[model samples]
Target: MRTGVNLAALATIALAFPSASSAQEWGFPGLGNAEFAAITAGGPAPRRDLTGAWDPGQAGIAGGDNYFNARTVPPLTPLGKEMLSRNRPTHGPYTAKVFEGNDPLTTQGDPSGFPRILNYEFRPMRIVQTPKAVLMLYSFNQSWRIIWTDGRALPQDPDPRWFGYSVGRWEDDTTFVVETVGLTERTWLDSGGFPHSEALRVQERYRRASENVIELTVTITDPLVYAKPWISRDRLPLKKLPEETDFLEQIYAASEVTGFKQNIADKARTQ
Candidate 1:
C-alpha cells in the first residue's frame, strides 16, 4: 500500500519545542519521572521521557479498546446531519489508492468489513526532542511523527495524506497548540471505530496539568461528514521503561481479499 503524507504540515510539527523545559516531570501513568541512564548517558537524545502504560479503568478502554475513541461531544450542525443520514461517500478530486473491495477513491474502507478498533493502547507516546521538531513516538504500529515548527506555513497545494498534516505553536510556557488539516476521508478516528471525512480539521492541545500528569484536549471538525464538531479530553501518566521497549501492528483479514472484494464488484455490475 502507498503512504500519503503532507510533508509541509509534518514539517511544521517537527519544528516546534526543541528545548522544552527540562523540568524533571513527565506526562502519563505506568511510567513516571524516573532517571534513565540511557537518556543521561547520551545527553538525553534518546531519552524515554514520555507518557506510558495506562489503564483507563474501563474494560476495552486501554490502548486495547480506545485509541482516540473516547466518547466525543461535538455539537452537530445542519450539514453534518444530512451526511450522517445516508453515509454517502465524498465525490470529488482524489488521487487515493484503490483496493479491489474497498472504496478505491474514498477514504473509508477496511478489509475487516466490520468497523475497526485498536485492540490495545500504545501507552507510551514518548516525545523525542530534536533541535527542529518534536517527534511523538508511538508504541503502536511504530507509528510516529515529526511535529514541525520550522517557521514555515502549511502548503497551499498539498496532496491528501492519511494522517493529513500537522503544525504546532506554543500556546504558553506549558501548553502546545496543534492544527491538522488536508487529511484523507478514509481514516477511522478512534479504535471504537469512529470515522471522518477528508475535510476534517483536528485541533489538539497538549497541557502539562501537573508534574506527572498531562492532558490532551482534542476538537475535531468535519462539516461534510459529521453532524457536529466533536471533542474529547484524555489524561495520561508519565512512564519509564528502563529494562525494555515495545511496539504493535495490525493485519487485515485475508478472506476479504477474494470474497468481499468480488462481492462489491458484482453488486456494481447489476446496478
Candidate 2:
C-alpha cells in the first residue's frame, strides 16, 4: 500500500533498468562499477561468513531478458516448448506486448517463485547465517527464504512450493553451495517465461571472493523441461552494503496492479 507511487515507472523498473535516480534510492543504492571495484579491493575476504546486505546492481537484473545464458540453453522438450508458448511475458526473447502479458507476478500479484526470484528484479538482500540455517531477506516483495544448514537430505516427493526447499553447505573455506528442489511449476524460470516442471532442481554457488564481494552462479536442471542442465547465472558479483544500510519497500500487491491497469495501462491502451 505505498501510495502516490507511479505504477508505470515501477513496472519499468522491474521489467527494465531503473532510472538512475530511482536506482540510487532503491535497495541500498547499488554501487556503480568503479565504486564496486574500489570497495572489493579494499579488504581480504573473511572465512565462512556471509552475513550482510548484498546487491549486484545492474548485473543482477539480467538485462531484463533471458536470464539463463540465452545463447547456450539446450533445445526445450516438447512439453517445455508448449509451456513457453503459453506464457506471454513482457520481457526476454519471447516478449509480448504489455497488455498481452500474463506474467503471474506482474498481472496477478503472485509470488515471484524460486529461481525466478533470483533471476529477475534481483535487488538488495540481507543474509543472516545461523548454526542451523541461512536466512535470506530480499528487498523485492519483502520476501525471505531459508537455506537449511542442519544436514538434512532433500525431500523425495515434496509438495510444490513457490520458493521450494533449500539446503546449503560450504564447499570450501570460501564457497557456499545451495541446492533447491520441489518448486511449483506455476512460475517461470525467468522473466523470459521459460518453463520448468516440479522436477526442477536448482543449484546456487556463493563464493565469498572478497570482504566486499560475493560471486554467485546458478545452474538449472530439469529433465522434463530442458534437454540438459544450463547455467542461469554465471558468477554474478554482489557487492556488500554497510551493516546499517536500509532497503526500500518494494512489494507488488494485487490492488496496486489492478489500480494501475485501470488508471494507467487501460488509459494508455485507449490513447
Residue-by-residue lDDT tens digits, candidate 2, 1-271: 3211134423433344333224344445455554444343225667888887787877776663435545857889999999888998877787777767788888788888899888987888889999999999988888999999999999999999999999999999999999999999999877778899999999999999876679999999999989999988888888766554578777889888777767765666532
Q: lDDT of each structure?
A: 0.42, 0.78
**Residues 64-180, model 1: lDDT tens digits:** 323432244354456544433333222212111223223421223332211111123333445655656667665433456666766667656567675556777767766767777
Where model 2 places Cα greater than 4 Å from the true spot, the runs are 1-29, 32-38, 64-70, 267-271
TM-scores for every predicted model: 0.53, 0.85
Which candidate leads the pack in lDDT?
2
Q: Best by TM-score, which number?
A: 2
